[model samples]
Target: MTAADDSPVHQGRRAALVRQLRARGIANEAVLTALGLVPRHLFFDSGLLPQAYQDKAFPIGAGQTISQPYTVAYQSALLAPQPGDRVLEIGTGSGYQACVLVALGAEVHTIELEPSLSARAGRLLARLGASATLYVGDGSVGLPTVAPFSGILVTAGARRVPPALLRQLAVGGRLVVPVGPADGIQRMLRIERESATAFRQETFADFRFVPLRGAEAVAPAPSQSGAETIRSAES
Candidate 1:
């Protein structure tokens, strides 16, 4: 089905999913509204249409899965994008998350490591008129040419926070990523760039995501700077 095929059943399902997200502690009304507007079923294959709004991750080919709705809502809530905010999404799987970001009125630049996924997502986003710029590249390094984003979100699990991404954040920008061993549960972290050389980090609930692919996936040397402060928070 195409993005234009949003019938009553699909609308009902989407609304239900939004309600579920709110009940699960996604307090960002704008994020929830964006989720309510985007048609999730259109991002799925015809065979998986029935499971589209179930708040579960399903394979989207290329060894990736469109993240579960709750995960998307949670991460988006943490990012707290304001209209016109420039945001970079590290993974473009299914382009669903990008669509959600666009619905929130953010300027989204999403990168995917897999060419096939990028192409498919590009076509779908274009058809939906989501207006997100899709790039096929090593997302771990981020899009340096478009540095200084108001927000950067990494959809995959990495060994540690990528320093390159931190460098790309605009002062006061936030980067939300899941960090831990690739094979185990990852702790969701929100790192905020406090100034030119200072950052503050806060940890959230644990989630399991596909391992991030690219050169920086191997654990990188820890940041040598002492200006960064880390704070842990339980969900």
Candidate 2:
């Protein structure tokens, strides 16, 4: 989101975003608060800022698009983050989703494979006075040292759930991601931990997302160091 500078017009738009989110069936106070606080326009291309609160997705850069408001809200509703809950986010494109999680009171630990995007988002979050542990690393592997997160969210689409992420999920924790082919069809999926070794996965409505890319998608090219960010068609 962008700096408001106390413009009445911009403040009006923020209120409208909240109403739009509510119309889309997001009733959670924390979710609404997050959506309202996040400057969606600041997270998108300057040319696309006018439509930021229109409840649609907009291109950010690197061929990746900040997800639509509803998709963000849908997954967030499922995340159910509580105060101080450590949440892991995959694909921290513009830090919008992570901002939302923070609004919902989660302590965010986000991984982004693209260095430039990671750096930009880190700066943006810091500028907003929010602090999150930003890791310029593969989201697929997750942050092993920060395992046992209370909640996990994959902003990108994955061919299948990454096993490493599953291993990091705390027992009874939940994860929400998009699962399907990137080019064809994708379904929003939510996974709930049944035990350390088991999880129950449920598919939500169809959606689209940037593909999840990392060393797991292909062997690590020696020249690459945390440079993978593929818009994988989730399978």
Candidate 3:
């Protein structure tokens, strides 16, 4: 059905998905609630609706997949956006993540590299009454015109954190992204801007994502480091 068709069946499936997410270690109530409220089925093509609430990723065209529900909730919990937090999302994808961020009461600004995907997501978001500013461009470099975001979420895999994204974060802001070889599993990293020149990094479980494209596809050479602290969940 359409976004407006949030029937009992859809609601029930959505609730079941939420429970599954909780059981899988998504403990943040706010993130769970947001996921519960967002009609994931609406983000899928009518023919793909059957698999919408399966907690699995599905192709969303243009070589990208609507991230599995667990991954979305996991990253949202890591970002921990407060109400009214200004958040930037790279790769808008199905705009499902942006809707989750909106449901969390954040001011959302999302950019996508694929114009068609961005257009489709914008229409869906508008239909659902989610207020998120959508842009079409190279998301790896981020939306600098609206820099200093309170939180940033990247939905793709990269070899290293883009310096531009880091520079766009407001002090205390968090950038949640996946970093690793393009052909291998990636570690989910939550990098928090502690100050003008210092950042704190936390590494989480491994996840495989479509390689981030555009300027981020080419790994950058290692350079002089900045002051940073790292903690790995696997440590």
Candidate 4:
């Protein structure tokens, strides 16, 4: 469906999903609430809707998958989003995560390395009535013009947290990423920028994701933002 059903049945499913996240150690009320409100089924094809609220990842094309619901809630809780935070998300994916960020009251700036996905996500977010600036480029390099963001979230697995993303964080800001070998499982990392040149990192649960790609991954910058290159399907 072009929009979430948002009917009683769908809303009940979302509520149950929130309960699942809570039992699984997602303690942030705001994160849980956001996850509960965004209808994950709307991010999937009609055939995949049956699996949308089950807390599992599902492919969304472009060789990418929308992250599992638990993973989304975990990352959102770890990011410790505050209202009005200027958050930079390194991978837009299906825009599900960005929608969560929006629901939590963050001012989001998201970048996707894949043009098609970026455009699709932008339109999806718009249709969901969420506001987030969407960019298509080297997510590994981050959005420099929006440097010093209050928080950052990276959805893909990286060999190492990109230095550029770390540099973009405001002092006292946090950057959550998944880091490890491309063919192996990745550790979810929370890095807090304590000062101009100092940061602290902590490792959380292991997860798997598509390998992040682009200039920081040894590729060139995308020539155009997906916004400039693709006509959003919903539009």
Candidate 5:
């Protein structure tokens, strides 16, 4: 199926997104600029591009759903990304949020567990001229070597905030993750690293997401004693 023209459609959708964002208490202009600039449809199924602006989630292949537009905007606003900040994003599902983050001129490095989805998103993001370091790995690990980022965002739900990710944050940096107990609902959490050893947690209202699965997820990956999987599976 042919996708809608990227410009006109996205412009209209962006206006609507901005309105929703304000209503939801997203007050950052930089975040709004990024949300308005990125073409959300580029990260969606071609056939559904026409409805890309609606405040709802759409199906992405591999059984994952691109987050609803409001959630993306909300999370970005909560993280309060700055133009020069280096942001590490976990779960690049459709690369929509990554695109939005980087479009505001953030230096973005994203990790995705599903190789197939990651590869496809890498190509599409490049086509949009979004500069992001895309890595196919476990989200639970968060991106190491590139630690001490200015901000971090995770797009999946986890039973508990993985402590490893918290350690990677630069002092005063923020890590936004979905944390909740299994069989219970999830809530958006903004964790600020007060120092190398402490974090301040700010919780938000209810939200739903795919469970976080990777080496550090609630369930340990299959391995013999002292052996590691090295990589996560495709979703």
Candidate 6:
């Protein structure tokens, strides 16, 4: 991390980011407060620490990019996890979003497509004193073993809501995701399970995200370090 990571300047930067999010219509007080407390700079490589709090996504490795602060806050606010709610997060990425969920009192179970990124994100979370179960696999399938999630958030853009994710959500649960063509901006969707066979979907904003890779997709080349994972896709 950079020298500013421990300096008051970084803290001030985080505060400023929170204010920016608020100005951009992020009104969830709990989400904003939790975001304010999480040190985003610590999640960055030392070289990129300076841009960590800039509300922009940065490449984390393995063709994946960390979701921007606004995107993270927007999705989390839509999911609206209650304290102690069990949340399943698809695409752990840099694990920044998982940390946010943990801070907001969710029992987070996050999955990543790349093993290296998964390992690296786990260590980062531990360093931040955040707790979340981490898994490396095809997140498109969701975690059936931990099914019935009270909240679900997908960090990548999908062609459509994966059937597995919809099936995993508990009745009355809410899922926030970005869905559209892989090469274009996606429509942010909030799907709420209203009953055993019914769901309600609300479309919000447009966002661009890395494609949500699955079991059928070819694996990315192995990386020596997750922090240095290659960006092969348009994130």
What is the Cα root-mean-square deviation between model 1 and the actual structure? Answer: 2.2
User: Residue by residue across 1-235, what tens digits does model 5's lDDT show?
Assistant: 1345466656777888888887878788888878887777777776896778888988787777899977888889888887889999989999999999987778999999889999999998888888899999988888778887999998988887776687788988988988776556799988887765556777787888888888788764334454311121121
TM-score for all predictions?
0.94, 0.87, 0.94, 0.90, 0.87, 0.89
In model 3, where do residues sit more than 4 Å from their true spots? 1-4, 225-235
lDDT of 2 at 82: 90
TM-score of 5: 0.87
Identify the runs in model 5 with alpha carbons over 4 angstroms from their true place.
Answer: 1-4, 182-184, 219-235
What's the lDDT of the predicted structure labeled candidate 6?
0.86
**lDDT (Cα, tens digit) per residue for candidate 3, span 111-175:** 99999999999999999999999999999899899988999999999888887888899999999
- Residue pairs with colliding backbones in model 2 are 1-39, 159-235, 180-234, 180-235, 181-233, 181-234, 182-233, 182-234, 211-231, 211-232
Between prediction 1 and prediction 5, the one with superior TM-score is 1
lDDT of 6 by residue, 113-149 (tens): 7899899999989987798999988988889998999
Query: Mind giving the per-residue lDDT tens digits that candidate 1 earns over 111-145?
Result: 99999999999999988889999999999999999
For residue 76, model 1's alpha carbon misses the true position, in angstroms, by 0.3
> What's the lDDT for residue 99 in model 4?
97
lDDT of 2 at 220: 36
RMSD score of candidate 6 (Å): 9.2
Model 2 agreement with the true structure over 38-145: per-residue lDDT tens digits = 766667666776787787887777877788888888889888899999999999998899888887889999998888889898888887777788999888888889
lDDT digits (tens) for residues 1-235 of candidate 4: 3433677788899999998889989999999889888988889988997887898999999899999999999899999889999999999999999999999999999998889999889888888889999998888899999888999999999887677887888988988999887889999988888777667787889999899887686543344443112221234
Model 3 / residue 168 / CA error / Å: 0.6
Candidate order (TM-score): 1, 3, 4, 6, 5, 2
Residue runs of model 4 more than 4 Å from their true location after superposition: 1-4, 218-235
Write down the TM-score for model 6: 0.89
